[model samples]
Target: MPSTKIGILETGGPPRELAERFGDYAAMMRRMLGEGYAYATYDVADALPATPEEQDAYIVTGSPAGVYEDHAWIEQLIGWLRQAKGRAKLVGICFGHQVMAEAFGGRVAQSDKGWGIGLHRYQLHERTEWMDHAAAIAIPVSHQDQIVELPPFSRIVGGSDFCRVGILAYEDQPAISFQCHPEFEPAFAKALIEARRDRLPDPDAAIASLDQPDDRERVAGWIRRFLDGLAAERS
Candidate 1:
């Protein structure tokens, strides 16, 4: 048997201290997939391979940038996603989720309602084998943009009051997307909130909300279960 190859699409963001301090997403993925898996990171906005045949699966990371921005590379990545649809497994987080939606003919825009930050609870839309144990999980969300409309054939799996399109999956594809940052841990969430405290409406309130221990564990468990499901599918 050969080692499974996973590609990570990274978006430019905070310094190494802040990004790496949160725990590397690639490392977490490797741990979840076990020893026979290798991970590679690609800066999507800078350079992305012309083909998806290079990796077994792809995981797109969160970004501070909006999906609607006029970035050339963003558009290129969206095109690549369309081309690779159904041919490979894809997981999109935060900005990656929004980008995936737009690539598949959905609409994404800034939330006029305001920012959805800190730990937020999302209710599972329906019971599915993919999310057998996920119900109301408190996941950390920090985003200004939201997917207002999903493309045809996409199922809304989970959502919160602030973000109606929290999680989405394609009907005939192995792609999964989350508007919330499942990659974020409690400490990272706190650090992110602090870093953007001045821009936030209520910084103190956000920081105080992170003290909930139950929410932290629930969110972490939800993420782990999700990854496990993907790993099981590969097997």
Candidate 2:
């Protein structure tokens, strides 16, 4: 009956100018996770712990950096994940998702299709006990890199035409990942799209996509259930 300890591996952040104006990624996560659980953020981009026993479960945050980048902390995180080897529950989002896929023998690369910035829908092809619904879920997205080849142990549970490997779960590992940003609220998502409007290949389209309603809280609820389920399994 104790509170769950969740380790948040902070990878990267938005522009300092924007973060000062709109809050950082960790703040969004704290809002999504609410008050029941305790979160300890290890700025993995800056430093990783000497041991993985720091928390009961782990959730890697999305990063602007690519998994293919030659960052020391990224490599270190991958090594830590290799060591974890299903010892604890690990949930990944966006860049975190890509890194987990890469660490587990999958391939991640910049897509030829260009930036995926905006609201997108993914069909839930398979359902786990953690999922409250099997219908499509709409979430904000902002990545061009994707998981093209999955690890042998991974199963594709959800996807869309925009991203084939939208969601993945490992058969042999206590892990799950989503390609979209469920932690992103409407205001943040709009600001992010506006912040990088010129850089995007289709900024107008991206802006237009924001017209759709978001289901951020719903996805966050499912993620909470998933983490709780992971805890229950070991208990």
Best by lDDT: 2
Give the number of colliding residue pairs in candidate 1: 0
- TM-scores for all candidates: the values are 0.87, 0.94
Candidate 1 per-residue lDDT over residues 64-123, each given as its tens digit: 789888888888889999988987778888888999999998999999988888877788
Model 2 spans > 4 angstroms off: 230-235
What's model 2's TM-score? 0.94
The residue pairs in collision within model 1 are none
lDDT of candidate 1 at residue 85, scale 0 to 100: 91
Q: Which candidate gets the maximum TM-score versus the true structure?
A: 2
Listing every candidate in turn, what is its Cα RMSD in Å to the true structure after a full C-alpha superposition? 3.4, 3.0
lDDT of each: 0.75, 0.85
